[model samples]
Target: MAVPPALETPESDGDATSGGPEDLQRQSWTRRTFGAVIENPHFRNLFIGNIFQFGSMQMQLVVRSWLVFHITGSFAALGTVALANAIPGLLLSPVGGLIADRAPKKTIIQSAQIYNMANAAVLAALAAGWLGVELAFWHLFLSSFLQGGVNSIMMPSRQSMISDLVPRDRLMNVIGINSSGQTFMQLVGPGIAGFLIAALSPAAVFGVMAALYFFAVTFTMRLPTKPLYAFAQSDAGRAAKQARSGGRRSNGFKDLKDGMRYVATDPTIRMLIMVNFLIVVVAMPYTMLLAGFVKDILHKGAFEQGILQSVQGLGAVGGSIFIASSASKGRGKMMIGWGALLGVGIVAFSISTSFWITLPIMIFIGAAQAGRMAIGQVLVQSYSEEEYRGRVQSVWFMQFSLVQFGTFLVSILAEFAGPQVAIGGLAALLVLAMGLIALFVPAMRRLD
Candidate 1:
């Protein structure tokens, strides 16, 4: 891609074109872009809201897996729960992306949060002993489905909104900070959930998650209303017209086809999608198998499991902070190189037999993953036009949903080949993927 033109200097009022020392400092904290929209209170609310939202989501994920395993003692059940969460997003996310472009983003995000809150409330009730375990499974599955739908809507809006919050120059930094916050939450939330589950009931964890969702809801509600861009408004009008004419299907293969077409035409985005798919397919399932790794392989229990998970998250937090601090220094290419190194670290993780050995490797893996993700976001957002930003983001989210497929495949492999072998195989696949991307996608390699 061509190097983007330099951003115009911001004005003294911290507006998009004038510049000064105070403006620079404010830009450092809020904008990240030379001429971007960083200082908006609305964006700050959204960013803060995301911390609680993503943190709660992560906590519930760890807690739910543990709870289900504790109750059923079945790896298959754990896989099934993952499937429940993944399928809806995979199926519905494209439509959600279209909606995000056409509808008001803040409203879309708020509605999704409300739906998410409801899901958590139901789960909390089940955890509090107001519902039966059998009923809990059904509720959990339903809630996962709902959450998946919400994510389909929420992910694109949240991602695309960042550019609107900060300028092009600071986009990389903002993404880094956003990712760092996510990693920070991952570092703390799991440990908290694990401790709570160990001391109290699993239901208590759910209750905590519900409270976090409530907080997110409050913050999201406070977001300032921003008008849709002209292209977005046009798309919305077209969609409405099609709906009125009975010519459009909200949920169908056609919507998926449109999304696929958008992704197919953009080479950078296509490569990014493929890489994301590979990562999810190869790396993410380790979380699913972690509890088993702790119990059956490592001969440890819940506390150790939590520590193992927390260590990886700590690594991610460290990585994210590093990226956030230095992204503006123009080392995007180097960061991608480090991401490949992270894959190597994950491979090392698979071969290790002891916690002492695995912990440090996992931390490095986290750092590498975060760095790659931060840089990758910068590349994708920079390359994509505002007209298709939501659609591009949806494609990215779809890769995440499809990661469940990888997880399921790996889970089955674990049953037949064992977790160690399965993980090792995934590591090899990731290395192979890295090599291929390095050879074929020079743009990605150059971090342009």
Candidate 2:
């Protein structure tokens, strides 16, 4: 497939009419306030795909958390399951990124979805008693590992593909819409999953997830076959030449190294990655502890856990809408700064014994989390060069995966310190880290 012409790169002059800082600021305001992604066909398809993908993924997450707790009745198993997912991404992300660069991104993403479908199917079959056997903990671990590997590949391609689908001016808006989709899935998917699990079996939830993947595959197939960026085409050419010459085997590690070098040298990109790392490491683990919060801490049940998760998703949806409609160019940095205040919200969640109070806190946490994530994605996508997009995206995936590792660490800490204390401590640490980040990372501090 032919590659699309690269969109004109955004100039750093900071003018609105002249492609300067002022211009970018004005454009940013428009992007944040409106649903800009609807204007692009490719992005529209991607957005639809994301809705299905995130809905399915989040549903699985909720179900898995419920399942592990139901079986083991321990918080550590949550950490273990999280670890199983993270380890593979950390190990394989570089390769996934490299493959995305050298091969057809659409193809890689499609294949990953297929792999995920297969995993989901296996889990469902096992659950449905069609493949009856002693399903050990190792089964969950293996499935998580494969899913993580697929995510490492899928994320970079998906992130890099956004710029291809829209003009540079619209990247933030597109990202906002993307965030909204994820948040929406979070809101609806988990609630549905919870209801289904309550009404039926864990296997039924897996079957629904498998069906969602089929929808994802169908949506992805509807996307344009062409490579989203010029650099991807160039990378493809280089890979072909290398393959013909037998110079080096084109694999993920080589691609990962190249991506790391790019990020290492670029201060803006480095800052973005670090900000993501800090947030995920410090604040992301709260989701893993939800079951504990509901069951043990709050003295509630599985149904309440699902409600809490849904409330968080509601917050994300609201934040995504606000960011999507707001018109501010350099506001991404501001969003990061302000969004970090979510740590305070999480802290409140930890301490609040009242369900009413905890519900609002979870909502704020979700909103702030969505805002931070949307802004962070826009910053990363805007700063990366088109040719190295896959590698860059892979690095993004690695950061998220590694953050999950950090979350796992937090889970381990919870095992010792207890869930409430661990969650509250992490939230405080995140607030402090955000302050330090704002002070140190100029890109994260300045608003255009």
| TM-score of every model versus the real structure | 0.83, 0.83
Q: Work out how many backbone clashes candidate 1 has.
A: 9
Task: Give per-residue lDDT, candidate 1, residue 98.
Answer: 74
Backbone clashes in model 1, listed as residue pairs: 9-17, 10-17, 10-18, 11-17, 11-18, 32-170, 33-170, 36-167, 37-165
Q: Stretches of candidate 2 above 4 Å error?
A: 1-37, 66-78, 132-136, 228-253, 295-297, 412-421
Q: Write the per-residue lDDT of candidate 1 for residues 116-235, one digit (tens) a residue.
A: 777777777777768754445666667777787778878988887776555565566567778888988988887788788889978788888878888888988876565412222345
RMSD of candidate 1 to the truth, in angstroms, is 5.0
Q: State which candidate has the highest lDDT.
A: 2
lDDT: worst 10-residue window of model 2 = 10-19
Task: Give the poorly placed runs of model 1, Cα more than 4 Å off.
Answer: 2-12, 15-40, 129-135, 198-200, 227-258, 328-332
